[model samples]
Target: MFACQVEVVVLTCEPLTMGEERYYAAEIVLKSDFVNGRVGLQVSLEDLDEWERCLDALEAEAGAEWPTGGRSAWLAVVPEDPVEVTVHDSPSTQIAVRMPIDVASDWLEENRLRLDRVQKAVATVS
Candidate 1:
């Protein structure tokens, strides 16, 4: 059992250019009773779909790690009785936060819908 409550919010998805390369950025904000942080995740349409697949195939002993496209920050999901969401930010110092939330019947569907919305938003950003 965990004592913290975690909430992840996707603020927006926008196109970003670094030098000559382009990528879609997802502004992810994570909040919990123990910690709060934000990250700009560089992802493609395929990445979003991959995440959906990860969520779909998640199991109690088999967890999933999100592709953060960074070495310092990372996110993972652990499927227990109460799903555990953990985010680690270690640009200079390590700050790892974990929280557990009850998995309602619609939780997975809700997450898939959120990912679909993000994919659409990314596709429309020109």
Candidate 2:
């Protein structure tokens, strides 16, 4: 069976000011039989929130790309028939891998749950 897993590890976070804004340092990990890529980048809460929205509203022609502008190592999900997941390294590395996975019908729900866990984890950071 093919497998694709994405994980976001919030290594540390700092308050941007005396407000709710935070500077989050996170590592995005994508793993499968064909790819094992990790990208470390700075993210805002909006980035994570937007990711959730993307997954929720995913469609064949409307795929999702994290970190939006390829500013760093990024991942994109192309929701074709089998759901293609692509992992790309920053321009310096220039390495990319794409693989199709046979996911359950509730894959989006599962991913949303995983992201929710990450969100909760980030909330506890000091």
Candidate 3:
């Protein structure tokens, strides 16, 4: 029997006058051979346009090449079927990405390209 699983880990950094507060949120889903592993991550933001802008800024800062622009970053994993995206009213903005456990290493490596930019951005605020 084939076994597969998917999980999502979100790391959010909020900057303050003195320092930054980082929040980590995670969700795990498992599937057996009979079922295909599926996972979705919801990113909440006060404004949809702002959320897109934030993601665009992140991509531009990272200078990482994406075939479909920054879509890969948030989708993380290209599902066989369309994944639903929900926008809601919230005080803070968030960006969520989902991926399969087996390819977690690959995802990490792909994302690591933005480490320098992320660090730089955080440093500027702190």
Candidate 4:
């Protein structure tokens, strides 16, 4: 298959309640050289699950704290050139949002549930 590098800049999940519909919506800013510079992608519960699967693989292959080459996020994919992706997505039915799904998931798991989120709720303005 194609070899590419993947990393996640940010991952966030917010509890949403709209009438009877309630769910946790998420946003993931997956950073990769293969696709755009910083691809801000959205994620749902299913997406988060998908990402966790990738994270599991990374943990199994590498340690929990994977080397980031002194970078903030871990290296999601191992190798690839962005140019090739551009070529493959050209012409009819041609478009690519080259986000490494697994990497985003790993980022989510790594950054999910923090201590600071337990702080007091925001106060309403008078």
Q: Which candidate should be chosen as best, given lDDT against the real structure?
A: 2
lDDT of 3 by residue, 10-88 (tens): 3343433322333222112334343323333332222223434444544344321112223222322222222222221
lDDT of 1 by residue, 22-119 (tens): 66766557666655667665666666677877777673357887764554355677878777877666463576677676656667677777777777
lDDT of 3: 0.32
Worst 10 residues of 3 by lDDT: 81-90
Q: Score every model by TM-score.
A: 0.72, 0.70, 0.27, 0.32
> In candidate 1, residue 111 scores what lDDT?
73
Local lDDT at 86 for model 1 = 75
Q: Is candidate 1 or candidate 3 better by TM-score?
A: 1
- Candidate 4: misplaced stretches above 4 Å? 1-8, 18-21, 30-47, 61-126
lDDT of 2 by residue, 1-126 (tens): 124354222223333433655756666566555445566666777787888778865833588877676566667777777777776777658887676776768777777777787788778774
Model 2: how far residue 98 lies from native, Å? 0.7
- Model 3 regions more than 4 Å off: 1-5, 18-100
Residue 60 of model 3 has an lDDT of 47
Which model, 2 or 3, shows the larger lDDT?
Answer: 2
Residue 69 in candidate 1, Cα distance off native in Å: 5.6
Look at candidate 1 and tell me the lDDT of residue 3.
29
Model 4, range 1-126, lDDT digits (tens) per residue?
A: 122255333444555555654444443344555444322222334444444454465445532322222222222342222212211122323333434333333333433333124111111110
Computed on alpha carbons, the lDDT of every model, listed in order, comes to 0.64, 0.65, 0.32, 0.34
Can you list the residue pairs that collide in candidate 4?
Answer: 3-79, 4-79, 6-76, 6-77, 51-105
By TM-score, is 3 or 4 better?
4
